[model samples]
Target chain A: MKGNSYLSRKLHSLLGVIPLSLFIITHALTNFSAVEGGSERFKAAVGFINGLPLVNVLELFGIFIPLIFHGVYGLYIAYQSNLNTGQFSYGRNWAFALQRISGVITFIFVFWHVYQTRFQVAIGGITHDQLGMTMHNIATNPLFFTLYVIGVLASTFHFANGMWAFLVSWGITVSPRAQRVSSYIWMVVFVLVSAMFLMSLSAFRGDEFKEAAAALDAIRTIV
Target chain B: MAETTVAKKSIKFVITRQDKPDSQPYKETFEIPYRPNMNVISALMEIQRNPVKDDGNKTSPVCWDSNCLEEVCGACSMVINGKPRQACTALIDKLEQPIRLEPMRTFPVVRDLVINRDRMFNALKRVKAWIPIDGTYDLGPGPRMKETKRQWAYELSKCMTCGVCLESCPNVNERNTFIGPAAISQVRLFNAHPTGEMNMEERLETLMSDGGIEGCGNSQNCVRACPKGIPLTTSIAAINKDTTKHMFKQWLGM
Candidate 1:
């Protein structure tokens, strides 16, 4: 295959940084809010987001379009690129491979997450209380919990490592010292975002949400 | 027994041949009387003397390029038994039967075992992969590199632009404009020179542009594939760091 086009590379880099990463960081922080203030706060945050004017448009153009392009283009790059970590497994080489792997995992997880939750909300079949309760019930399932943990890990690593790559690829942190410094910063982000995801998941595991989920199940059965 | 040994001593070759650019490639087999310690270049020369197919048909002599019949010139680089390397160093007895030879596809195939390496040269030009001290008068002795630095720089200096690394690089194909690892490593070499440092920013700027360092996907294959054993991936990592610093310098308006 021919080399990457200027426009494609530029757009890929740009999309990763802009709306996509911005949304990811925000989503992580919002999830952390669930841990900070419980299901009521989580419901308020989700409701505010779901209730925002033109939120559908924002999700479509701001998040989904850019995300799809970044992901598809990333796969194209990964295909055009060779993997040789078997012989030359340097830190950067491993990171390069992990970046692509995590990108794929994150891509699948994002779509599945949206399909499971947001799509239901869009169809008016799920309310804010149900959102929290559904998440609580799903978290109780060992398989779903494991998948969620893996999904969160993949996304956190992808975003953090993607930031590191963007720095060098864009010529932002050219010096080894500067890159090392930036790497330290990205490591912190990795740890923090990962903690945020775990904390959010723990909030879903709480007994309060478990009781709410049980009550909702009883109501559904009766209805 | 001597006559049987003599009759059995023949080198078999399976060569990929393309009559012209844009033409389909076909395979041709040739059997040449073996010589002791014969490299691929000498074997090809023996075939050139006969210019006949193994089946006793008169056909055109096999086409390939070489100079310095030693591995230094890098002109004789081609795929020998599925590996991109110099034919001048590939000995017949060291290779498997029916040794396969093909032109490096990283560059456009010109004819039979020859390819145009203009892509690499163009990249060198783009990165200004040289020192700029041209003058008629005698120039003063340049600054010396530290002994430790000289050792590795000497190693980096061995790249012959053989296109072997490019051929093995997945990112250097026809669809991608990645200048490949050879050029990026050369940038590391040039930027290390005392005089070459004068144009370091310009070189880094070129590397920061399209099809430059950004195109590298860090496959790490270049270092493994390099016939000269240049530290390609290390150079790329080093230059990657350099370009990032250069960008910061530009941002600081330094």
Candidate 2:
């Protein structure tokens, strides 16, 4: 097993899609709910997730643990890659290089994002209901807003491009035509997912969210 | 006047040369009288005969490996004008002027334009990329393949082990032991055969090891780089599936 990195590599690919990708989709949709149905809707979505039976266990095994392995191992893989896209300039070659680049960006962004939101909740610095207010504050800052935009783009690209690699490596798309089709499909996924995320970001800065954040702050002051 | 000028036309070559395997490489330029439909190999031959630089200095003849004088042999694979292909088929008419010839640096340079292809041969051996027929006694009329399967498999069989696929692959360089694309495609070719199917599991096991099928980053440069147009990525994807199934079978203790 010393020289055999096969199982580990496959596990990395598997963990990327199984819980990680699934988690990302749910997360984007949940955030989009803030814009679609406003703060109350976003609260209900978070509440429903947090209220699930054995929610802590689910988060630990389903999201956090898998995420740690995927991110840490992904960093190792990114480091191992010797990108020659400058010389090659092939479409897949650029995808290969961009995949690793986006992985690194997404990893850092995800770490900071989880720390700013989820970790803050865990540490009692902000309650679950105050998540909207917290996001509002972050989104209003021009620098943070720009960072969030870049982060969302990188994360979506990583997920979508990763999905393409996963399909091919798992033997789902075995032919060149199948691979070409798969790439086009994933490109669409990247665009749609990125749009969803960016929409949520803009929603945070909306008047409705600002009013809701103000109401939350007023109640907190009164209490 | 135009006929004489056309007859006196010449091609310029800028070739990288190394005196020894461990020595640094240097560039030498040569101008050769061009002929119609002459390929890179022919120009190199003219240089070999003259052994003179464009600067009118006497020099050593350029060295390269080639056989079959056709694309069939994997030999004579060198980087011509920044692309990896066989010099035998790289017609001078098609290439840009002052054509740069260099060794396919993926493999160690033995001399000018000659690379030691032991890595590819080792990869083939590692995968046991052949049917294990007993040659001591005659084994006649082995299992036959379906015409449809044989049609595609025949396309895969055109691999000359030219090392171009390896040269084009980012993962098959000095930092990693990636067995590269050619041998992986060869595995698909052999494993599809009736007699060859016997050792399919063994071959898959090797692919499951380090520097095996797992090394493919899916950059997909191999398929495009292959002069024969072998479906390298398709074979890689197929082998990826096989190895996954094989891993499960091993886990199940079957």
Badly placed stretches (over 4 Å) of model 1 are A1-69, A72-76, A79-105, A128-214, A220-223, B1-7, B135-141
> B31-93 in candidate 1: lDDT tens per residue?
888779999999998888898888999778888999887678889899888888999999888
Q: Across residues A1-223, which tens digit of lDDT does each residue of candidate 1 receive?
A: 2453644675788799998889988898878777989877887888788788998899899998999989988887877666556534656667778888888898899888888787887788877678887788778889989999999999999899888777766656655577679879998999999999898998888888877777888998999
Local accuracy by lDDT, each model: 0.83, 0.91
Give iRMSD, candidate 1: 4.5
Each prediction's RMSD over C-alphas, in Å, is: 5.9, 2.2
- lDDT for A116 (candidate 2): 95
Best by lDDT: 2
Error of 2 at B63 (Å): 1.8
**Where is the poorest 10-residue window by lDDT in model 1 chain B?**
B1-10
